[model samples]
Target: MTTPHNPLCPTHHGGRCPAPAPATLLFLHGMGATARSWDPVVRRLPATAHTLAYDQRGHGHSAFGRRPPTGLAQLGDDLARVLTHPSDCFPGPMVLVGHSAGGIAIMHCAATHPHLFGTRVTGAALISTTAGRLDPTCGLRAPAGPALARLFLHLTRSRTPVSSLLLHLMTTTRWPLYGRTAPRPTRRACSAMIRSTPPATLDALLRRLSTHDGPALTALTRVPVLIAVGADDRLTPRPHSRALAQLLPHAHLVEVAGAGHVLPLEAPDLLAHHLRRLLPPE
Candidate 1:
């Protein structure tokens, strides 16, 4: 008989991170992804940088959450809880790194929990994300992408099979979810995580994201920010990142050429280089 696997112990590759390091890095992933998604990116970081990349609620090891999945506020709460906890692992300043929906969660947390961000969050990186307007645009040539997304959310209110179909569409590298050079392993990893995720989790989050706005961004204007996006991304295009940069007075924008939505995996080295800039010399 096959043994059951533990969802909490995510399948992130690379050696374990050392504790009590001077700097702490918290990595958050987007929808349909897990902590393992940061494997390639984290491996490229400095050896001394302590990092924790956890599966956000409902994606990998995390649960679908008890609250209604209206928007990223719930996930933002999760981040706040972890960072504010009285744990040595989270002590000192933190560099927040988020991609896509993960970015949205970080933004929500920053916007809503100013005390947490002002005290602990020293730097942030928002990749391929927007404060709002996702529903109006950001689809793959689908003018009604937002409406279609809403329809899917309604169809898969609770744990359902609709997410599986959506997963399959995004699994293939040939699909627009990734860049042309994105490794097959990256695609495979995303497929596995999405297959295991509940439809309710994705549906609720996406539904809430439809109404996402950036009033919270007002809190992050003073924090150093990096806005990166794939030049060819059909999902959350460069325009969204550019708009976010404008909101952040200390934000810098970087556009990766020929890359698509999967910026972390497709351009790990480039992403790492940018992340390194956020840290002081070892």
Candidate 2:
């Protein structure tokens, strides 16, 4: 079934903004994250640039029907639908900002619809994302040790029962394991966000992440792209972001020193500073 035209707004909770048409920015959240995740960063954007942050299907307030497809192709279709909807509330040459999986979605969309880059999407920002897998041999490996790597793999491959247990462990006790490395406030915020996400959805998304190799880096080469990563991010790692920047001849790589996986939260001001420079004038 097609996603409903009246899909739940991503900011339905405490951040919803009901401004009129001409939204200058379309913000996409990563897997297991809702639009709320952008709250800290969006507030830092220029007030002139209206923002539309929303949850993807099967996550947040959006419909969770039949565990929506994980392919970036499907995500591209959804994005196109959102932008080309009959209502068409967004203005011309919008800036698409995505984090993690959301960044992957943007890259897929741009690659599939190359014309949208300069013609429609003025620019794109990919925060804490990778062009390919996290394999050590691939030269983009995270700092995750063998034990953590084994746990991650097991959690990804486990069935319902083991997966459920793993999810609880990660969400409850292990979440802080990652967050502790982030700024204290950012860590707390990210912890809450992670806890809010459903284990099943998280597991499903993680599985997709393992095999998700799309045209992100290749697509960014043709567009004005910004690739940012945290210096301390163990998930995507700084090296992956560097590799992605190298692949994109014109991409700007911003490394947030001392920041972790949740750079948006850890250094929202810094991120906003870069965003202001990259986004077109209103």
Candidate 3:
């Protein structure tokens, strides 16, 4: 199958200059993270592949996005904007890689713009994401789970001190890295990207996740999909991945052992290995 040239892509100068790489990959970072979070995985890919990663709204370099309610609808629009812009998109259909909330963002885009799946996107990798009902008490302790989930829910409305404390705890105390600590550079990169995001971003993300429509994700059925998760993941537990896999049998599901919520940082090479498999042969 021949992919139509982007026409506007600089390298697509007809018969005048050599066209750019045939395959393009776009990376979307998770909530409270910048595009830099995918650096580890991106770096491991072959240099010839066209790759792009950018800060999501209110995270890192991107703006706070006019205001808070940047829910799935707005995020879906944002993804479409990035993909259609001449400067943002590559010359070929894209293999979309997204993590955590970023995964939902990709799904939202696919859900709303089904046409893009065939014309602009080749495949998608949904990493550490959930479709809906994200408030499952998967990782918390048995007896106190409901209370903690309720507390987390109440704090989702941007109760500053609690929200800040919860985020701080999540970053420092929770299982950001599993089995062992990530490399120094990876740790530093994750810290810088995550720390730069404001409290309101996290608040809006939780609210959206809580209310997202699961049926919307059916739009992804039009293309090949990959669902990858960490074996020891507590946040979006492995079962979530399993359920999503069942939803799309055409999709592949992979669980990286000894990994947690942050697979991009925890196992960059491993994650990149999976990504490379989806690429077209050179």
Candidate 4:
């Protein structure tokens, strides 16, 4: 299932290039995160690398649209569309890099559409994600669950006109990282990403997470897989990643010491190193 060469790719030198073009990297962000969250890691890739990152439905620049999707299928279907969408222009082998919910979406897509994975997807990295048993409570005590989380999301749907400081503080405090302190800018950026999500979208996603059984990932067994998790990640802790690795017995699992849920921002360098391993040698 070879994709036609993308003439516009930098490596396509008048159809006379000596080697096959590098796989285009497609990045998917987790819940409450925008494509912008990938900036740090994308920056670390080679200059000529082909990369694509976009806000998932109801996230960042993308809208929630008429009806909010009730299951992971919609998310997976959305990913399929992105891969095949003509305007996105990814006409070659791909390496999928998904964080958290993004990784879950990838699993659903691969399971539902094995044909697509068999052909174009050559590699994948599932980071800070889980296969099943996602605790949507997010470590909150009993009684302070999804409803309260939705309320918080509602409050942050828009920037507050008065006391914006307090709003930012509230958002930052909820960020699910471990003990190590993130740089001020990274913390602020992550907070802003979460704030951008509409409450409805967040609510729907939380519901989906709570009910979803793990997707059948047999299709992924054909590809090179890297499973990474923050050792101290509280949201989808290391045990979650261990379960995922057990399912994909051949996967390489890396536990980043002291890092947390925000692996893309928290440890971009380590991610960049592993992502390069999936790419063809230059």
Candidate 5:
């Protein structure tokens, strides 16, 4: 479907414009993160680039009234809406840039709606994410698995009040687990985003992450993709990124030494430099 001439503007101050109409760059943040997480990276982009970053449903400034769907495919749908919705602020070709869970969302969108990409999506950057869950071998175990499971069951089967209480605990209490290794500033930012999200959305989304098949690496062959990982990323290790890179026909893999999963904050300049190389000049 052709993207609308005008799209929904979710930012507090409408949307910022990139002078000279540079290619649109849509940034998707990791699970439990808000669009503000992209501030550092966005600031480094070429001044002429138009940009749009929104709280995905449950995350930032977006509507918290409805519970965000849990499945990755549903998240993909949300992304499609953002890109092609009639009232969306973004127009023309877009280069999708996603970090961690957001990267997975982008992959699902690209795979299911290849036509939407067309010539408009020049490339994609998947940072610190894997194609599938690593429950069995990744060594990073869910700390409160039992509590999480109980909360999930309650939310899915119980009343909104009970579920809401459980959700608050799950989202607020478990946020530290998600970014346990992130640096102090990054951790604070991530925590704030999670706290801002609705309990129902956080509960459902986390449950989805366990079973979500982010992207079938092999399916990315048609698009120009880049997979980068921190060499020391214990959560979604470097090996996972390597495995994903191997599946893409037109993919390039970059390993950032000593960098962890939070490369965007940990090494903004390095990440920006790579993005500059991947993005075409205006």
Candidate 6:
């Protein structure tokens, strides 16, 4: 159902005020990913579930303004703006689900705008993400880490066909991103998403993420939170989720076995179940 088109709702809806509705599920994707990353999880949710997944700045259809610095702070501000404006897709209370870099953005938003929690943001699910420090760790440390990082940055800065081809080749190899259980089709879809990311966006987000520090999120304590990580995730592994759980003492932490970094795609059923639990009774 859509809200009527009004100053509150615009021609997109046709009402002066946004219609009250069940809690909305706002899904945020990680770096180098788009709103489509949540497609699998959203498909598993109940038909009546009010859901909205949009490309964060610099990803998917969202334009990346070159003038502004792209980082967690900017992303957080963007999220705040979206929440502040109640539209047909974002009406009333919301349960936010963020993955990877997207989770960091959520934490930043919550930290800066604590007032939004418990009221506008009823709950949150952080999947395969960390508060900050996205560089190589024990779980993901490798001799090629630095080299890969450098290569990625270089590739993302260039818009040449060769650079794009290289990125496509690198992303098409699915072993590093998915667990043993993830189907081939899922990996292909993920690869496509990564390949489609604008080179400029990739470069900007990567540079910021490399130095990102975990955001202080005391505000999250005011609401139900689910901190989930994949046991096999090399990037932002269990330790990261544990730290998040510690930050929010009341959060429920779940480590899914045989899964990798892309929980929304690799384990949609599990994510869908937890998201539903966090939603307010309709």
Per-residue lDDT of model 4, residues 22-74, tens digit only: 58788889887887888899888876676767778777777666775566668
lDDT by residue (1-282, candidate 5, tens digit) is 111112354232334433334456677887667778787887776655576676665666566444455566666777887776653344566778888878888878877776666465667889998887554223434665656555555554544433354335324543323334455666566556666666666566655665666554434565578788887775588777887877775688898876777777766777777777666666
- Which is the leading candidate under TM-score? 3
Q: After superposing candidate 4, which stretches have Cα over 4 Å from the reference?
A: 1-20, 136-170
Model 4, C-alpha of 185: deviation from truth (Å): 1.9
lDDT of 4: 0.75
Off by over 4 Å in 5: 1-22, 64-66, 86-90, 136-183, 214-219
Q: How many clashes would you count in candidate 3?
A: 0
Listed per candidate, the RMSD to the true structure in angstroms reads 4.5, 4.3, 5.4, 6.3, 5.2, 4.8
After superposing all C-alphas onto the true structure, candidate 5 shows an RMSD in angstroms of: 5.2
Name the better of 1 and 5 by TM-score. 1
Task: Report the Cα lDDT for candidate 3.
Answer: 0.71
Provide TM-scores for the models.
Answer: 0.84, 0.81, 0.85, 0.81, 0.76, 0.83
The per-candidate count of clashes, in order, stands at 1, 0, 0, 0, 6, 7
Give the Cα RMSD of candidate 4.
6.3
lDDT of 2 by residue, 77-116 (tens): 6776676654434445567888888888887787777766
lDDT rank order = 6, 4, 1, 3, 2, 5
lDDT of each: 0.72, 0.66, 0.71, 0.75, 0.65, 0.75
Instruction: Give the clashing pairs for model 5.
Output: 7-87, 7-88, 7-89, 8-87, 8-88, 8-89
Off by over 4 Å in 3: 1-19, 87-89, 136-138, 157-162, 176-188
